[model samples]
Target: MRPSVSKPPACLLLALTSIFLNAQTTSQPVISADARTVQLERRLETISSALVAARQQVDQSLQQIHELQQELAEIKQQLPSAQTVPPNSSSSIADPLAALKTSVTDVQERQDTLEAQVKLHDQTKVESDSKYPIHLSGLVLFNAFANRGNVDNIDLPAIAISQPDGASGGSLGAGLRQTILGIEGSGPRIAGARTSANVNMDFFAGLAYANFGTSAGIVRMRTASINLDWPKDSVQAGLVGPLISPLSPTSYATVAEPGMAWAGNLWTWAPQLRYAHQFPLQEDKHVQFEFGLWDTPSSGYNTSDVLRSPSPSEQSRQPAYETRVSYGTSSVDRGLQVGLGGYYSRQHYPYNNNDSWAATVDWRVPLGARFEFSGEGYRGRSLGGLGGGVYKDVLYGTNPVTGAPAFVGLNAIGGWAQFKSHFTQSFEANAATGQDNGFADDFHSIILPSTATSLQLRARNRMIVGNLIYRPKTYLIFSPEYRRIWTWPIYGQGNTADVFTLSMGYQF
Candidate 1:
């Protein structure tokens, strides 16, 4: 005869298997404390389910034990005193009863443990002062770079500039000023819409004038918005991206300034009130219409930082107007989108009143599962405040013919396009090029003078960039980028520069 052996309950086997699998998969990066909490919650859920099954099994066993007790009583009544029953029989009944009791005790202990763990998890959650749900997200970034020619700024340079006299070589540097922090919260619904708000800040304002100022970056507000969203309509008010030109190239190396800032990317953030409505179309297609009132300051109009004064645009006592219409497929990847936009504003300068305006077109097209293309184009005048026209809004100097003060809004046309290949969920590559050209005729004879400021003379700027971004973990990123910039002045020879950068960041 084979020897008899005790077997563990099925619920216990299932629970142990789940725990072992979870442990095996959790070798991946934890990302944040919140992620660990989520893991714990899932584990507790699995264990709780097992405990429920164990409890049911115990209940069934108790029912059988009660039936067995009743059967024994009936047997005693039928067999009479002679049925003193075998000693072995009493031992067998007691042993099975003991086993069922042990199973019940085990399940109860597990349930208690699960309850304690759940309570602990609740105690560790972050709570907002107002008792609303709040989230904190940010990136800690480090960048190292090298440049091969003269440029406007060493770190995150935008345009190439003429080499100064006696300038011998390029420069190399590293910094962490691009790090960012953001806070967001959701509020109670109001006016039949969900309300939420977010604010983002970065340490990229500028360096101090003191020692080691390179590492002492000032804090700056990047963007902030309050949103009221319904099923198909939404309203937003805050410091946000320009409504006319809505897209930017992908780059981790140019966070302080967006990619291709002076060379076609018009990505200035400003205060605005926006209203948007979406119309659902056939299939997964949709159309969106956006209108906004924006506070557009004049380019290079403010000379004093310590005093509060109205900008040229503000002095006009009018806000900029912007509108855009876009068509898109609402697929998981947003398969295709195309937009057309318009902008108009008035600038009141001491010398004259000028108009700042633009007409824009933007597009995003997916080539396939792994490739995509995106771009934006615009023709505008006096758009320097919007990161256009080589960062100049107008040419200001004495008129050559009249010998009087003259101000001309610079006419400019610019655009940027990028080809992106997403090789996998964690790796990608991008190549892009852009150009912003200010009409040389707009400058007239202003640049011929030996006394004119350099900003007033630039006529065109162009750039090409290529980068590879890799994410070994969800919360970590690494990228290496190369960029070439060419800048032209209304007078004299053009300048070119080559920049190389490595960026690493951790996000949470």
Candidate 2:
């Protein structure tokens, strides 16, 4: 004879199916790709809670079954030894006990099903050729924008410029070049330190400018690093931003170059080897020191797209040096912090050698639970490659007396600050402003070359931005942003432009 079988209740079956579907289809928004792990942890917690409740109900049922069996045994013992139960009475007593056993078996099957689900979830990981595990994360971002005046790069403008003859005066467009993709992995620990690596890329290298140029963006590497992290020290080597200028205003609308690229944010990524050490303090506070050697590029110079050439800094045959010291809460994502940093490089030019240097200060202060302030400021010369001095490292012209080419490193001071309000976990607002000013004295008596671009003579650039980001669903984001830029040329009237953008993104 076939053995009896029990099926799960319709409600329980439906709940399990829903959970599986949710895990496969739903995700949470994270500040960065690394935060994907946090979202996964939250999902696991929810499932664990459900499993615990079901187990508790099964335990109670088992206890009641035991009590019933005990009572039946006692009643049987009280009867006379020769007494025989009637068929009908025996049927009534045994049927209920058999039913109780079946119920317990059903609950046990449900528990087994839940355990299998958790095991399956744990096994759902990216398969790698190597023994180590790998994970994939990314953001698919779409941006629609409208510009009310002439500006450089219509989709991702950095500066306002004077309108030329027959100019359209404005433009409306959309694109997906800001989308980012990343891959991360972990390796075996060595010398009491954990090892990890990640690489990020986007389609922001350049545009095709063809019939479907907006849809055809070139792929480019954003940043990549291999890190060894100890409890109080770390080492990183890869392409990254300058060590002296680490803080940048947060804005999804400006992911290609960050919130303030040419207008004050010194964020040109370069290959570097860096080391950091931390000193623990009371509570959550700590002090850190960081140093790095970077392969800085030369700004205000053109390079061939088809051939490789050494930049002025590279021609110097020496790497740039940078160092920073900061004190703050140990949290890397957010908290209170203040940092001071410095950068130095030697640039070899055809005419002469120039010393490129900067002093920088950055800060992040929490005003309360819902608000925070962050900013970075710097004073430097010959910093155009690092996004300063109005994108000009040095001004060149004919010397009046000697009739020989002369070059002078451009001096500039600029910074950006932002005020952020986190009204809730799923919504926030931000306002920020930045400026990059090249001193007028640095531009005097210099005759711009005929081959120079219109922006080569730019003396100053200022920008203001405001935006609201809302997350209606866990992994969906919608943001609307406004930006205004004012730019002044060395010998011409200043120009202005206003930009409005709507950005939508899905994270996974």
RMSD to truth, every model: 23.9, 24.8
Runs off by more than 4 Å, candidate 2 = 1-121, 208-213, 300-302, 445-452
TM-score of each: 0.75, 0.76
Worst 10 residues of 2 by lDDT: 1-10
Clashes of 1: 0
Per-residue CA lDDT of candidate 2, range 197-268, in tens? 999999998876776535668999999999999998999999899988888997888998888998889999
Model 1 scores worst on lDDT over the 10 consecutive residues at 74-83
Cα shift from native, residue 423, model 1 (Å):
1.0
| Model 2 backbone overlap count | 0
Tens-digit lDDT string for candidate 1 (308-345): 67877899999999999999987644379899999999
Error of 2 at 341 (Å): 0.2
